[model samples]
Target: MRFKSYWRTTVVAAIFLHFFVCLGLALALPLLDFEGAPIAAQEMEVVDLSEGDDGNADTEKPEPPEVKPPAPEPPAPEKPEPEPEELVLPVEMSPTEAAELDETVAEMQKQEEEAKKRGEDGKDVRPPAPPNQEVGTIISSGMTPDTRGTDFRGTVGVLVDVDAQGKIVGVFLSRKSGRFVVDQIVLNALKTFKFEPALDMNGNPMKTKRLINFPFDGSGPHPFDDDENKRMRAKRELFLRERQQQGNAPAN
Candidate 1:
């Protein structure tokens, strides 16, 4: 019996020693880390092995994504040219007056051309004061009535430039009549005028300028301007004196 009891006691003691050793080993395993912390308490690190789509990490920046430049804008269109302007004319002279003026201008031009062909004929042989406005030629007055019911009246001063051969080379306005139609009619009529050629000191024909004031009223412009009358008087006296001298001269 003593032997059996002692054998039971030994078996119980061996079982208790085995259980304590297993528990101690389980607790000591978590302290195996050098920092004495549990394995799960430490932070775990992760690494990426991903590369470029071409399988190489340094694959030429994917060809710079094909950065295309913008296209240029189209050129602008050109503009069209402007149209011409039309003038409205007013008839201030009667049929008879117009016809007379035309005939006079034509006759004067014909006479001047004939005189020029004849080479310094006795036509412009006298040096009348202020030149031009010879005694024989009758130049029609400027500025006929504004037959239009407008009753517009103003003085239109015109500057005429006559050439050595009595041709109307140029005509310009020295003063405006403030009426466009009236001014234009005066300008056009003045163009048809011809002057007697002025004479130089040697009695040779010379170019000259004259300013004539056309004063308009209820009866259109007066027949002649002041300057015109002055020149006419001077020229008529000179012409009469020349004629008297010729008459007094002894026959050759």
Candidate 2:
């Protein structure tokens, strides 16, 4: 009987606790007061103007006046004067002055000769190589084929009148390798040459001559031959492959 009484008391206590909790929660919640002061909604104001009326109600903008620049003054008249008569003077050159004049002329001639010599000695002259050769040199000295082995042969020379910018202005076969193939090789190899230009007396760059030559390998084709396409293609492929591997791996 005592156990039964205890169990009944516990059950009744649990039911009362649950009822109290629910009732407290319901009482704690805020009440919705729909009957209190209501919010007022604002209405947009509309205005209408006649076709001839300005939109500003209290102020009107004035029209701008036309502006005219002042007139330019007339140009001054040119003045003309009389021509003067020519005058002659009975001046005589001294003996010393005459001697100096002769010396001056002689010195100029000597200078001209010296210049010519210097030009011949590779002093102020460009090489007499072909344009292509000059271009090759300017672009890359390596492009200028070497005259080493007969099998790996080429000529060495210059092209004259190469523009200051290294463009071939003229090609001269100065040091020919005696083979048409060799000569053509020199010419063809120069197509890629470029120059920084040679300077003149005034330090300004001027077109000049250059010289180059090549040798013939009885077997090898001319350097200028269009047979380098295969080599060029291989180089291109290699470059592309290198670039392809240069970046980080794409996100998987």
Candidate 3:
């Protein structure tokens, strides 16, 4: 009986030890320090951000700005003040006076119609000529440059005459030369020119043309007729008389 008790005790002790050791190991394992576990990856659904067919997002959009209220219309402008009515004198209408007024108005209308017709037809009218105040002509002095080296010089005058018709009726040199070439040149030069008709004392239209003179200097060809020689001699005698008078006068 003693030996059987001892074996039973030993087996019980072994089982108890084994149970306590397991318990202690479980508790110690909890106390041991270890690194923290890695974080777990979470699953998220992917979404595309492309524009929709409607060109607007499926979600509600933000509200738009509110429109401002329109300004009140301005009051209509005040009507302009009525003009004061003119006072009219009451008079009995006379047949004779009415007839005279109608005749005067008709005459005025006829004159206006005639003027219009003339203007449209471009006729029965003439432009007023430019005013002529008689600008003097250029007269050549009796001097020739020695460079022209001529034996004689001729004096010529352009006699311009104005007519009542305001036309250039005549243009001739008071003294004529047989030289056709020189005469023609002088005539042609004058012909090319035009002048505004001068006004007479009565302010009526009068034709006027310029007269130019080329004084005979002691150069160029001296083609003089008998009449011209006589006139020249007379001019010389007059010049001599003037000179003698001047010589007799006392010096001022």
Best model number under lDDT = 1
lDDT against the true structure, each candidate: 0.58, 0.50, 0.49
lDDT of candidate 1 over 136-209, digit per residue (tens): 33243433444344466666766566667666665555567777887776766564454566655445567765
Worst 10-residue lDDT window for candidate 3 reads 135-144
Q: Estimated TM-score per prediction?
A: 0.37, 0.28, 0.24
Q: What is the lDDT of residue 35 in candidate 3?
A: 73
Candidate numbers sorted by lDDT from highest down = 1, 2, 3
Query: Taking the tens digit of each residue's C-alpha lDDT, what string does model 3 give over 10-106?
Result: 9999999999999999999988878778899999886666664344466666677999999999999999998743222214558996566456445
> By TM-score, how accurate is candidate 3?
0.24
Error of 3 at 228 (Å): 23
Please report, as a residue range, the 10-residue window in candidate 2 with the lowest summed lDDT. Answer: 133-142
lDDT of 2 by residue, 1-252 (tens): 344358788999999999999998798765656578888999988889878677877886677798999899898897787663222211456889656745644554354345345454466432233333322222223254444444545434433445676566655444456666656656666655544554443334566543333444444333332212233235445544655666555756
